[model samples]
Target: MKVRDSFSLNPVGNTSKYTDFINYIDTSSVNAGLLSEVSFLEDEFPSRAQRLVRPGDILYSSVRPNLRHYYLYNDSYEHAVASTGFVLLRNNSSYNTRFAFYYLSTNEVVKYLSNIAELSQSTFPSFSSKDIGKIDLPDIDRKAQDQIVSILSAYDNLIEVNNKRIKVLEQMAENLYKEWFVRFRFPGHEKADFENGIPKGWAYRRADEVIDFNPTLKTGNQTEFTIIPMEALSTNSMVLDSGCFVRQDSISGRRSQNGDTLLAKITPCLENGKTGFVMGMPENEVLGGSTEFVVMRSKALTPHYVYCIARSYYFRQTAILSMNGADGRQRVDEDKLKSTKILQPEKTVLDHFETIVTPIFDGVYQMVQENKNLIQQRDLLLPRLMSGKLEV
Candidate 1:
């Protein structure tokens, strides 16, 4: 059956004039199977904020359909307005909304939409709301659909819980770094002496003194290395996406090994805090990623310590200030980054700090790996269930 037979497209339209502070959703705010963030629209762009969205509606990106940016709206986003870039799918009496959402999120539907989009004559590939409505969907029984949704949602729910735990763990590490290093409130602060606002033995040194910036790139076509693109690095997550493997010769980006930190050096991405520590890549396997990254390895500090320092608000602010180039194409100045000052604590104190935060970061890495596995499992089961190859 056609999707239109089971769902209505954007059932509500924003026609009221008195409504203020419209909740808005854009393509970038939506991740695959997740709604990461939303923007609230005021009176500034009245015309662009006319597509009213309601609870249970699926907002699927019509433009750049291959990215598969879609989300199921809930009470949190009730009465929101989304950009026209989305094809809102509102479930009807014939199908369950959760089932419709999961079906749309399937790889099969994404591939279908992507093929339809590529066939378009427009310079930027896209499909219309009518086009979306025409796509055929399985007319599964509602009970079976409910069973499928329940099974899949269980994995997603666990992943979400792990993500929250990871966030708190990361924050705890960052906060500890701030308290000890930034605020000079280390364990022995009462007995420690200070000279000119510096700890008695601690010294201000250039970042290069402790961190190696963009070390030598390994070259060869013989080995298969994991390639991490800019999109694979989520802002502030400090975890690299499970990247694809390619022959070394095909890669033209910065090279890194496990334990190195990656920072997006380009505009917007840098501003968005695209920084992560390289973890869980096969042991001893060389990793290559976007050339726009400044790969930093710690020589004197612990890897976790370096990651926290790089992701610190002060460091990011300084890096942003040092960026130079034309608008939208600006990049961080490597020289400026190397010259940035770093606070070096006594070896014992550094050891204590590392001891305290290492397990926290280790837990974060473990959670990231678990989430990746969960996503893989869910994706693998998706097609089988959707096609009835596996009974729910």
Candidate 2:
């Protein structure tokens, strides 16, 4: 059956003007089957904001359908306004909302929508509300639908839990970095003598002196390597997303290896903290990523220390100030980055700092890898259950 027969598209229009602040959801805020963030619409774009979403409504992106950015609204987001780029799907009495969400998020359904967008011939391909309504869906028994949702939601719940734990662990590590390095309160600090606003042996060195920025790696066409796209780097985390495979000739971007740090040098991404520590790659394997990345590898410092420095608030501010270009296309000045001053502690103290934080970072890496595995398992199970190939 067509989706329109089972669901209503953008059914609720704004009846009253929102006098106060409004919870706004944009295309960038939604990922595939997930709502990562929201923006506030205050006295601007009033007409552009019209769709009123309620609990159980699904907001699916209409433009760039290949992105598959969609979200299932709940009570927490009640009365929120979504941009016109979304087609809100509210289930009718004939079908289950949760079941529809899973079906629409399937690989097959997304591919169909992507094909439809391509056929539109627009510069930026998109599908209309009517086009989305015409997409096909299965008519399954309600009882069976609930079972399928239950099965899929279990994995999602566990993933959420892991994500929370990952956040806590990351906070713990960041706090430690600040306490010991930024605050100069490392263990036995009272015994160390301070001279000229720095410890006895510590020195402020230019970033390029201690770190290699965007170094080249040699690889041939036959060599297979992981390609890390800018989208693969999450704004909220330091771990790179599971990357795609490509031959050496196809790789065109900043090259990095395990233990290197990647910083997005672009405007919004730089401000959003799109930094990652390259990990989980095979030993000696070189990975290529978006050219927008400023790949920082350690020379005189430990990799962990270099990563912490790159992710530090001070570094981000300096990078942001160094950015230059047109509005949205602004990029960080690589020379400025290379010339940025970084504090370096004594060798023994640096080693001690590494000893303290290595285990914490290791734990975070494990959790990230585990989440990737969980997502893979959930994706694998989704299509089978949705198609009734495996009974709920």
Candidate 3:
């Protein structure tokens, strides 16, 4: 059967009530089923934010379908609208909505739509709802669809659980940093000498004095190295992707290693918290990343400590304030970022803090690796299950 036979394409959801604010989801706010942003806007909403989304609706970006910028909207937002760039699919058939979502997300179907989008007359690669409506999908019974969804949903559930654990672990480390460094409540605080608002041995120093900003690294005669693009960095997490490798002769970006912290210097990205702690790479792998990253390596402080500071609100706000250029293209100035002042904790306190948080950071990375494996297993089974080659 065709998609249009089973789903109501871009059905207008009820937006009957008046509200002072809206939760807006832009096309760029979603990626591969991950809903990264839901802007709570009280003033002037974007002109494109016109498509209202109801619970259980599928939001698929009309532009660049291959990037898989899609989401299954399941939140309880009373007044939420999506950018007009999406084709909202609401199931009206006997088939399960989740089953239809999985079918649409398969690589084969995505590539098929992407080809049509590329050949279209639009200014950019994009397709209309008619393109989606014309595609063929199996007319499976509700029981069969439920079985397929059950198998796929198991993997997704595990991923969600791990994500929650990762968030908790990150919060633990951040809280520790604040308690020890920011609040000056480290071990034996009562006995510590205070002078001029700081402990006797501690002093506020320029960031560059303690951390190496965009420090040079030597990639010894390697023919190729891993390349991590800006999108691979998570705005809310410290774990980074195991980037794909590219030949050394072709191109290169900012050089970093497993222990470095990558801070996005660009406007919206930096403002959105695109900072990552590089980890889970092979031993001594010299990694290359987006030119927009300010690669930070610790010189006088622990690596974990520096990473926490990079994630800190104070440090990010400082970097955001130092940004220059036009509105969308603004970037943090390296010189100004390096000159920003940060508290320099005493050596004993720094070492003790690291000792406490090292396991927390390690645990986060372990869960990240686990999630990668889960995704790979799910992708391998997706096509087989969708095609009925592997019986449910």
Candidate 4:
């Protein structure tokens, strides 16, 4: 049925209203994107004008519906204030947030909201309380709500934990970069000079000086192509697909090579950490990706160092600062990439660094790939689990 029909069906009878009514704007403030932890609303909106989050408020993101980001609020965030974008539905202080949260949470609801989400045609998607609360849901009391929420939240928390682990590994790579390159206090630092903080023996060099930059061979015309596209990327790794393929745009204009660094030049994607080394390109006719990827030559710069630098805070900052464009279609310059400065270590030193960090990035990328598998498994299980086709 059409999503509009879901609201009118009045599938839920608890008779909840738009969030604005009970959403007490707290004098307290929370920064919207600040929270990186597992708890919902860890990073909520920043408002000196505070709003209260009672233990039972259901949290939803008005923007970026793609995240499908919805959560049941709990006493853990009792005094927290959410951004205006989120609405807090307090179930008459009697209904459990978890119970209502489960019934309210549905793939159907997300699909319905996404169809009508608000966004500048060029930007991310958004929704409103009228759009939200009006969606269909199963009505139930706090106790049963507790059981459903308990199960879901437990799984959600596990996902959050894995996310945190990924973050820690990311941090470790950064710290290692700083220690060996910035501090210049490596195993051989003592024999090296202390020129300008870098080890005295270490020489400053440009990437162009260290590595040969090979632009990939461009695929021609409007010919059809299949690809294990670089949809998910990191400095060290990327996720490839076999079944999914699309027409090659200028961004998708090039043939991927064994050691290419697939840097997403487009905004949001560039910022979303889509830049990564392309070691996963399948050797076959079912292949070709965007011109957004420029092959990085590791002739002098080892692929490992190339991956590390691309993913470091330094390169990310540079890339972010260099972005330009209007509307939601902002992008970084492919030309500007060559102009970025790079630090080059001695060949042997780079090799050693590669030896140590190669496995680290490999493991991290493997984990990400593993998490991708877990996501598929969990999603496959969702219908069965929720519909009782499969018992937890």
**Top-lDDT structure, candidate number:** 3
Residue-wise C-alpha lDDT for candidate 4, range 1-392, written one tens digit per residue = 22233222112222122223223232111111112322223333334213355555555666655445455555363244544555455554454545445544456555666777754363666766666666544444446556655665666566557656767776676678788877776777777766676655467665567655555455545365544344434322243332234554333455555555566677656665666555444453334666554556575677767766776777777777877889667777645666677887777887788788777766656765665565555455544544655544
| Pairwise lDDT winner, candidates 1 and 2 | 2
All candidates: CA RMSD (Å): 3.0, 2.8, 2.1, 8.1
Ranking by TM-score: 3, 2, 1, 4
Report backbone clashes per prediction: 0, 0, 0, 20
lDDT of 4 at 349: 81
Q: Give the TM-score of candidate 3.
A: 0.93
Compared with the true structure, what per-residue lDDT tens digits does model 1 show for residues 306-336?
8988898888988999999999999999899
Kindly list the per-residue Cα lDDT of model 2 for residues 1-392, writing each as its tens digit.
88898888879686366766788887766777766566665666546577787888899998887777888887475358888789988888668888888888888888888888888987788988898788777878889988898988898888778778888888888888898889899888999999888889999999999998998887644367678878766666776656333445456788899899989999888887788888877888778888887899999999999988988999999999999999999999999999999999999989998888888888888887887788889999999998789986
Residue pair clashes in candidate 1: none
TM-score of each: 0.88, 0.89, 0.93, 0.64
Better of 2 and 3 by TM-score: 3
Higher-TM-score candidate of 1 and 4: 1
Overall lDDT per candidate, in order of appearance: 0.81, 0.83, 0.86, 0.54
Top-TM-score structure, candidate number: 3
Q: Alpha carbon lDDT of residue 73, candidate 2?
A: 84
In candidate 4, clashing pairs total 20
